[model samples]
Target: MDNDRAFMLSHTFLLKSVKPFGEGLWQPGASGAPWRSDAAEPTADDCVCSIAIFTEEPGTIDLDGTSVSLSKGSAIQLRSGGRFSVQSGSGSATGRLAGWLVEFFVFRFGDSRPIAGGFPLLPYHQEIAVHPFAALCSVVDRITRTADGYDDPTALRKQAALLELLALLMENQQRSHMLDNAAAAVKRAISYVRDHYTEPLTVEQLASIAGVGRWQFSELFRRLTGKRPLDYINTIRLNRAKELLLLTDDPLREIAQSVGFRDEYYFNRKFSRMFGCAPKSFARSGKTAASRQPLLPAAKQARVRSSLTGEPSRLVVCGGILGDVLSLGVKPLGAELAVMGRQVVYRDKLAGILDVGIGGDADTIAALQPDLVLLEKEGVAASHFQSAAAPVVSFRRTEDVTVRLRAIAALLGAEREADEWIARHEDAASSMWNRLRSRIGTGETATVLVQIGVQLFVMGNRGLAATLYHPRGFSSSEGAAKLAEGSERFREITAEQLPGYDGDRLFLLFSGDERSKREARQLTETSAWQSLHAFRSGNIHMTEAKWNYDDSLTRGQLLPVLPHILSSRI
Candidate 1:
């Protein structure tokens, strides 16, 4: 990589009031609004030429040798790769005061810099005047109303109005327009390629997404991202493929198709060139894209890149999703996983790893020096470690465990481990099915009953029910289904309704609390409990009271003893 591309740096948003403009998703030709944000500092930009028009001032943009005051109605322009440290005091809208002072991130692509007029624009961070500011505001308001969501006539109107504003601004000596109104066009297209890379991606399709001509989008995308349109698509696809290569045992053809390379051979050649090694070798050795990335960046900076030492890299997991990544056999930098209700008992698996509290201080986390920081959600307190030291990711819990599992697998460079575990699980599950198929038929109904002190509950997709019956296709009793219908996991019920929840098979899950145990022992002895056919006919089983929580680690443990427990041996 060239020095310009390799050493390139950008500013990031620390805090912003900029919601998704124009229909909640950013696309080309859509207009943006003036935003009131509280970004204390910056590390990267939105990969665009930014126009910061300050309507109010509480922030200071720090430069190498000086500081720039973001005074009222003053505007500053920053290009791609420009870095600035700013502190905005969450501006206000009280009585004649503007709620937001800045409207930023416009005219992104470099092609727009050479305007039709010889406008020099103002010096960077020197605070310049913007004439006809109200006219600029009117054009932006029209854009918000005009651009709906696609390549329609409304979008044309929005784009035209925005271009008119750009042209007017370019006429000013302090500000010049770049590429007419195609400022954010290329960045939007690049973002589309990143998000939807798995789909059928072509230059023409991306251009359409950007609302630009095929040739125009192609040329501009190359200039901004430093790769051809198709090449950029391939970069995303094969990068994901490398993850799957390490994470899944699926066939090459299937992996290829999954990552958008229908032809396995073509993918193989590209992978070889990109990584300097074949796919199989890479997976077996757990080689990452870092084997070919600029070593200085990954080594010198903490940007969530992998280590070449041939093992899962050290990680820092913040939030409750610790179990998801832990189940992949990847040890994190922290001491132990966070303790939520009922999950404290499963902490033994984190034997070698140190246990860190969920609310660890920011300084302590930075001292641990994790390579990647995984947040359960975007609002995790651990996000403070997102500096030049480590990359912080918010891995939200998705509907599918495979999506979550595969993503974490790639991140930790545990693809082989993941693939092996998955294959082993499939085999065990299949064997279990074959063993019980003769005994448990398709017509059989299974229901999980929970006892916690005086609380009687029914289980749904969360606890043992998801493992025992959801994938196994066991039917829920009429009452059990009805009881769990309103809840995603467990629903508490009255003791009088326990008999109605009984199915062909009954599993007793306890909360393990003292009150639950005492109440359960007393209740099971009652005639009301013994009246159920499943309870009296040797079809009832006792399950681990504490393993009812959802997570990959707990689920993996359940798979091993599942058949034995189902046979009433437990």
Candidate 2:
């Protein structure tokens, strides 16, 4: 790699926003309505990394053959050689889309040494913490202010800051380390791919499932699991193909296409490479037969059906956010209940009690007289629900969806319902995952900054803090977690404090009342916030105050909205 090329490659440019290069920067489309670039493909030498921040202006880009409308605060990093065009449309109803963009050159030393490929994006296996966006803006401001007289000292400072920013981005984008969390992400991704494989499964969509960036995710996945990202994806696709081959006796070409393979020959070759036999041979050998066993036995299946269609049934759901309770309760035959106070005991002999909050007192357990009680969170005890004459079911609140479901089902004498619910939800979640996988088959993944109340958290290996963005994806950021937690206060920091805060998109959460809205407005007005790319581009979202002290179902409420929020932002 040339020294300059290497230097560029070594330095990652964080883009907070992009606007046409012109004055009226604050005005949407002030540079001119977005238009397609008629220029031919430019050489690497002809391209330079340029980051710009802008308000949300309607804009379109022809990516490959598809036209993608760029939402406000949406950041894009382009290689010098890539050819693209942009056209502007009407601004968002809120007026201007706010955000900033920072462009840094990438130097490819040579084909043999890819700067990113050579470095492990995340060395640690923990959740990524969200860095304040203000810190990123400060770095960009400093660099731009001294651009005319770029001295050695300035260059050195810039280099160091850039490196720190990259480090932070990598840290925030690391996948959750916990096996269950990782498995959930994988399962969700698979579901998405299966559901929308007919569309496109870009790398960006997959990263959305894993809640990380395309590049960082690629590195992390490779480091943790010994397979390349695409290789792993193909493995999943092939497995599905094998299943189809055995189950339905679908034609080889149809099965290949159904699983995302465009060419039958290529699919067969790839299948042979991985499984040591052609698709036909594998199907004939009953390899796929082994994959088709009902996840549960006949008895279990019958039980599940009975539970779903049974008489006015009782559901003991535990360990979900308050929104989950509301969603579940509103459903027919769904009675939402929570154990209050501490020290609830389960006698195991009595029937379960579903306490539905009479006034604010869960003490009504004694008044209602039930068989079992379910408790969640800390500070609630078994003795509280003992008087209700029932067994108490208690479990830790985490991402262990199966364990949580099992506990709840046992209490309600609806173990079969729990199984069926899990099966159904898992199946639904899986289908969604497959659709996403197919959509962004291998596109670039964006870096995201999630803001909670006072602190910013990142997506790490534990996956505890990751939240799904609605319509299509998930994001790992401190802010996102904090929002999920429904925090009221947030840390106020300068842009300089957050280094890699540049290229990532920002998702802001706020309490619903007028006061929270006022605070959100105040935060947006701050110089630090304005400087950060997401704020300037209107990428910042004022999320509903779903998870407050009074409302404990934050996770439940946020999960469904996640995909929608993410899709809108994109």
Best by TM-score: 1
Query: What are the per-model numbers of colliding residue pairs?
Result: 21, 120
Off by over 4 Å in 2: 1-362, 410-465, 469-475, 478-503, 536-538, 547-570
Worst 10 residues of 1 by lDDT: 20-29
Q: Over all chains combined, what TM-score does candidate 1 have? A: 0.42
| Candidate 2 lDDT, 460-551, residue by residue in tens | 21221233332234343444334334432233444455434442455555545576656666766767777866655555544543422222
User: Mind giving the per-residue lDDT tens digits that candidate 1 earns over 1-570?
Assistant: 243233223211111112221111112113322122535322223323444554443334445445454544445554433444444422112233221222233222443321211112334455444467676556545544523365767655655664564444544532323443453776767666655777887777778878888887776665454468898789778877876765466778888888888788898999999877788876666533332333234343333434423233466766555677666766676633455522544576565555556554466667777666666643444346645166655544322344456666656556666655654554455445543443465667888878765677887656667666543446787776764454446677776777778888888876666666566667777888788877676677766566675666766777756755664422
TM-score of each: 0.42, 0.37
Candidate 2: global Cα-lDDT?
0.44
